[model samples]
Structures are given as structure tokens and as C-alpha cells.
Target: MKVTLDIDPGHTQDEIIIRCAELNDDLLKIVALANSSQKKVVGSLGKQTFLLEPGDVYYFECVDDKVFIYTKSKIYDCALRLYEIEEKFQGTNFLRANKSTIINLAKVRSLNPILNGKIEVELENGEKQIISRQYAPALKEKLGLGR
Candidate 1:
């Protein structure tokens, strides 16, 4: 893949054009990355607070009928459901590791396949999550390992 960046000082606004013969995984990844960078997290406390930084998030998990955004320092309760969060972060390096968990792929350090088609993911922050057999295929696809 060849990438070119052109900057014109004469223009007041930055313009980006991606020229590609076809939309492949690489292109999809680039698009996903750009989208994720622009995504904002709004807390459920009704204050409408936004978390702009992506690296500040450890993972997002659904537990006991509530959604929670886990960070390195704190955890914030979210109003959205697990499926809603999954849709928003689908192509943004976030995967549904299990029925109740949506993990940030960028934070994953290693993947360990356990018995009965289950897998354990080790996050960069040393947190672990189990990937159910049903969602393992999708996780593998996101990892670029193919089906």
C-alpha cells in the first residue's frame, strides 16, 4: 500500500483524499482509526461530559444491566447498552470479546486460546477477559487472522 499526504499552505482548511483501487483491510483500518479518534464518550450522569482521549480508556464492559467505561484511573457508568457501544466502536479496534464485555483491541497485549473454543485476552493494563466461542470468529477477523 502506498500513502501520500499533500499539504497546501494556501488553503485555510485541511482536506483529505484517500485514493485507492479498492477498499481493503488496510483502508478500512485507516478509516476506522480516524473515526475512533473523533469518537466522544458521554457519561450517564446527565451532565453530558465527554472523554476525548482514546488512550485513557481501558475497556468498556456491561455488567448487571448497566454499562461501564473503565479507565486507568476511574470507571464511569454509561447509559448506552452493550450492543449500542459495540456498534459505535465496531471498526475502531474494539471487539465484543464476550457476551458481556467489549474490549479495546488496542489495549490487548496477548490472546490465549483456552479450551472449548474460548479465548482469554490479556490487556495492556494487565486486565483479562474471556472471549466466548460465538464471538471468537469476529475477534479473529478483527485481528486479521481470517476465518
Candidate 2:
């Protein structure tokens, strides 16, 4: 696939045009990535509020009834519940690892099998999370990795 960009000084809106001879899984994935509607969410750390892009999130965790979104360097509290966050990023890069945590597959650096039928995933930032046995198969399927 070829990608081209046009620099229009007077352009008011951004647009993407795909010129392809045939559509395949790669093209479909390109479209899915380009057409991301859930671009950002609201999060707060202590007293400072900020907009968080899903691509920047390493994972989401629910602790003591509060939901926290983790990035590479910071953790922010979000107003949405775990279930809500799970539903929002369902078809995207986020996948549920357990009852209390949702992980971003894009941030994963390595995955290793554990003795308890679970998987130990190491994120790009060096943090690790355990994928429960119940969620292991689905995560492997998503990544096209054998169980």
C-alpha cells in the first residue's frame, strides 16, 4: 500500500483517501486504524484533569471501586467504570486480562506462559500483568498466537 500526504495551507478539515486495487485484511486494518472514533477520554490525577488517547494507555485497572488508567509514566483516575471502559474499547487494542484489569495489546513487549494456565504479559514500560486462565485463550486468539 502507498501512503501520500497533501499539504494544503487553506484546508480546514483533515481527510483520508485510500486508493487500492484490492481490499484485504491489511487494508481493513488500515481503515479501522484511520477511522478511530473513540479518540480520547477524560481522566484526572489528584487535581489535574487531562484528555487521554487510547493509544497512550497501557491498561485500566479497578481498585477499591475506583478506576485508574495507566500510561507509561503516570496513572490517572477515570470517571468511567471498568465495564464501561471494557465496552468502549472492545474491538480496539484493549482486551480484558481478568476481572479487574484491561490491557492494551499494542503496549505488550513479551508474553510468557505461567504454571497456573495463565499468561504473564510484560508491557513496553517494563510493567507486567497476569492474564487469568479464563481470559488466556481469547487473548491468544486476538494476537494470532497459539494457546
Q: Say which candidate scores most in TM-score.
A: 1
Q: Which stretches of candidate 1 lie over 4 Å from their true place?
A: 8-10, 44-48
lDDT for 116 in candidate 1 is 90
* Reference-based lDDT, residue 58, model 2: 95
Model 1 lDDT, residue 48, Cα = 59
For residues 24-132, write the lDDT of model 2, one tens digit per residue: 8677766766654546867998899999888999999999999999998989999999898877776677899999999999999999999889999999999999999
TM-score for candidate 2: 0.84
lDDT of 2 at 34: 66
Candidate 1 per-residue lDDT over residues 34-105, each given as its tens digit: 888888876643555666466567788888898888877678888789899888877887788887888888
Q: Which ten residues in a row have the lowest lDDT in candidate 2?
A: 30-39
Each model's lDDT:
0.81, 0.87
Error of 2 at 54 (Å): 2.0
